[model samples]
Target: MSAESLERRTRNYLNNNVPQIQDHGGHFEVEDVDEETGEVTVAIGGACSGCGIAPMTMNAIKHRLPDEVSDISKVTVRQANGPRAAVMPNKTDEMEAMEEYQDYNPPF
Candidate 1:
């Protein structure tokens, strides 16, 4: 397929899959897609940044992008972490939440 065709397919796939991430309380926005390299660079915003589910998004967004466009070979995700951003509720809250999630009393 042509480069233009590849770009369109990749863009469409990205746009389609991003909304589904809402189930995980996260979202992805595709910033730019390189047809030649099959590299997609996207920004993770909203509930995704500091959420407990952020890490999983790495695979969901980065790994699957290439599936959309056959020519896409790589995906680069860039995150924007800011003090006052909505993604960050607060440092103390974030740390506490992570710790709590880590501490588990497993069933024998």
Candidate 2:
């Protein structure tokens, strides 16, 4: 598939299967697609900066993205705010509530 098509497909997959990303004010950006190797790089940003579930989100992208998006053999996720953001000093009630669903695995 063309790079544009691949990116579009990836975005659609994220929207449909990983709605939490958008629901939480986060977003995924298709940074690059290696047509020759079937590899994709994505960046997760916005509220995801200090999200407690950011690691899970990245893991899902790495393991599940390929299964949903055609022509994608591997996925690399980049955190926009760097690794430090993964650990925040405080957690709000909403964030704590989200922890209850940490094991959530979206239906394919």
Candidate 3:
């Protein structure tokens, strides 16, 4: 349940799952896991940067991450490069934005 252990397991899982992605010129990098909130932050780069299916890929990754690592409750995928800046917003800031948006919007 430690952050280090979760990180190692996540990296191993990514290595196993992402070779084909890398072969396609896409890459996934495990950035950090917050033990306090059980959120895993990942960066997707290379061909995945501007991929049309990036949202689907992100959802797939989000669903898979927690299943693979019991300590993780959620996964956040960040585009390392796209229309957005190379440096992504902090996970906390992203979470806050999502929360604020959700407060004013109804669930689909």
TM per prediction? 0.58, 0.75, 0.68
Per residue, candidate 1 scores C-alpha lDDT tens digits across 1-108 of 666676677667756656545655656666676666666677776666766545555556676766655777888876655563465443433543676745532111
**Residue pairs of candidate 1 with colliding backbone atoms:** 38-72, 38-73
| Model 1: residues with Cα > 4 Å off, grouped in runs | 1-7, 22-26, 82-108
Q: What's the lDDT for all of these models?
A: 0.61, 0.78, 0.70
Please write out the lDDT profile of model 3 over residues 1-108, one tens digit for every residue: 788888888888877775655776888888888888888899888776655555556666777878877778888887786564334333433543575534432111
Q: For residues 30-88, what per-residue lDDT tens digits would candidate 2 score against the true structure?
A: 88988878899999887787776676678778999888777999999987865445555
The candidate 3 region of ten consecutive residues with least summed lDDT is 99-108
User: Judged by lDDT, which candidate is best?
Assistant: 2
lDDT for predicted candidate 2 compared with the true structure = 0.78
Candidate 2 scores a C-alpha RMSD against the true structure in Å of 4.9
Ranking by TM-score: 2, 3, 1
Each prediction's total of clashing residue pairs, residues at least 3 apart in sequence or on different chains, is 2, 0, 0
Residue 103 CA displacement from its true place in model 3, Å: 32
